[model samples]
Target: MPTIVHEFDWPDRIVVGTVGQPGARTFYLQVRGGRRVVSAALEKEQSAILAEKIDEILDELMAGEGNPFSIQATTPVELVDNEPLEMPVDEQFRTGAIGLGWDPATAQVVIEAYPLVVVDEADIELSEDGDGVEAIVVEPEEMLLVRMPVGTARAFAKRTREIVGAGRPLCPRCGDPMDPEGHDCVFPEA
Candidate 1:
């Protein structure tokens, strides 16, 4: 678990912090240059929980009523992937905060830690030849296949499904999901 300071303005300060085990998540908050900030990210559906924990930890941090710092391993939080990470609420908002370029407010705000950065394997899709993307999968950074037996494969698939879900739609042209179909897109599909 890394030490973090909430980057929020006045009255806001370091609230809580968490670290993840293998395939888990890490969270934290801190204060630097007189700003409070929260730092974390879950699949998407887990934002609220992380936000809640940040609030809770803020309460605890304020208990001392001085330069504050509070840290703890969160109670397994369910992430948007529908899998439980030993952190607080499953927060997918972490990605929204970071990936979507949603910066912490410079004025009146909440603060906490979020983990959005990850070293992911290259993703492979079925391409334009498949039936609406037979599958979208991720393997280790440079690996080509899973080296597991049937039973392990089943278990892994189950867990992955629990984590990745059916899969989120993407922008056909930009290769990102900015809007659903039927809606106008800045970058139209060719």
Candidate 2:
């Protein structure tokens, strides 16, 4: 019989940690001393986040040791869904999670839109079919921004909105995406 594994439980001894990436829709986590497992308890929207967190954790573990660890011990150390595949982020999102603010002392990014915010933003070129990224624009959260085609801008905006509605992959506040490992938001008090 074909084995269908929906989700697995973590062991009692496994420890859990989190990893956040910039502009990523889901929060990646690091689970220590556990079996190789996938989850499906989360909704379609959550599939991306869980997969991202798991991949990140596993990658780190593999990179550090140069070998895949055996997933031993099975029980829930932390909450995780084993189903639902996360949506892939476009190339333009490289700096999508950067906040809106300009640092006078630092450089800035170029935005295609006018009156750009001070936060970091990326410029993506859309193709006629409008699926894969044609090109990318990276700039600081200040000064000169890039220019985009009308159609491309519209598509980019729509994607950005989707990420935000998904609970933001980076800091809870500021709405900036974090690195694959995550970033500490330094937003100042008002």
Candidate 3:
């Protein structure tokens, strides 16, 4: 199948948001502008990793020989998600591999996400689909590509980090995430 690429060279608004409860939350990356909008769903881990990588890229740029990371504008440094999802909230795909890079000439950061394919051992035990005739098939993979200014990329990284950390707090005892009700931590302290 041909690869489906969604490109947003300079989106008016690009943001990451989570829906549902903390532990069961769903992460979405949305870009809006030019009569087009794309939203991709991804695991929380992927989101966190993406944010970390972006941060690393910025750090490297800042430490470059002459510091070539000077793509700044009047855009707000903080992330604002006031804009609602571009209706329907249709997820393009479940992100598998994420890629990022900096274009010096354009001073823009390129972000890419590939669809993920999941396998299950229980599939071998299944006889047929609910129709009792056709079998389940994997969905075609799609990729999302977005190019934005360095400053905007920085804001995205910061906001992503914040969102990922905004989940349940750590239980100082077991070094695990704590629930609101309580935890069954055996070792309350070391």
Candidate 4:
């Protein structure tokens, strides 16, 4: 089957937002271009790492000797989006893998999210000669792709970090997330 690609080049709005309470929040990477919107469910760690990597890429570009592309070191004020995820919040797919890259030509950050792949015994195929097992390869049925300029990228990272940090507080002693009801801390022996 051919893969369905929800591509948004130079998206007008792209962000990582959550639904539900902090402890049980569901993180979503949503992008909008015109009236078209795509939302992909992702883990909190994935969102945090994506933001960290994007900042690293932008910072590196900014620190270049001449700074040719003029990457912004901070999120542009005008591009800051604090609004909640778009209405309906229809989830197209749950992200299995995320790919990030920089397009030097356009000075844009490219993000690609692939749907989780589930392999069943039926998916496995036998070798031509049926002598040995064939290698297994899994492909997603759909993916979300977005490209954002430097300023927008910076803003995206900033908002994503904030959203990730807003989750449950960490236990001061054990460094584990604290549940609203309570927390059991296990201290290490000296």
Best by lDDT, which number?
A: 4
- Between candidates 2 and 4, the one scoring higher on TM-score is 4
Candidate 4 residue-wise lDDT, 101-120, digit = tens: 99998999999999988779
TM-score, candidate number 4:
0.92
> TM-scores, in order shown?
0.20, 0.19, 0.79, 0.92
Candidates' lDDT values, in order?
Answer: 0.33, 0.30, 0.77, 0.92
Q: What tens digits encode model 2's per-residue C-alpha lDDT throughout 1-190?
A: 3322222122211111112332433322111124442211222233344234334433344465434343222222233233222323112112123112211222211131122224334444334446665654433332212222222222323333343345435556676665656577788446
- lDDT string for model 1 (1-190, tens) is 3333333333222222334432243432222233222333334344334444433443453465552333222322331122233333343234323211112222112323334435434535443444564654332222111122212222322343333333445557766544333545677656
lDDT, candidate 3, at 77: 38
Model 2 residue 158 CA deviation in Å: 0.1
What RMSD does each model have against the real structure?
Answer: 20.7, 22.0, 7.9, 3.1
Q: Tens digit of lDDT per residue, candidate 3, span 69-186? A: 5634323636444444466777878788788998787888899887886767554333476677855565445788899887788788777877888788888877788888888897
Provide backbone clash counts, one per model. 35, 39, 0, 0
Q: Which segments of candidate 1 are over 4 A away from where they belong? A: 1-150, 158-165, 179-186
> What is the Cα root-mean-square deviation between model 2 and the actual structure?
22.0
Model 1: how far residue 169 lies from native, Å: 1.1
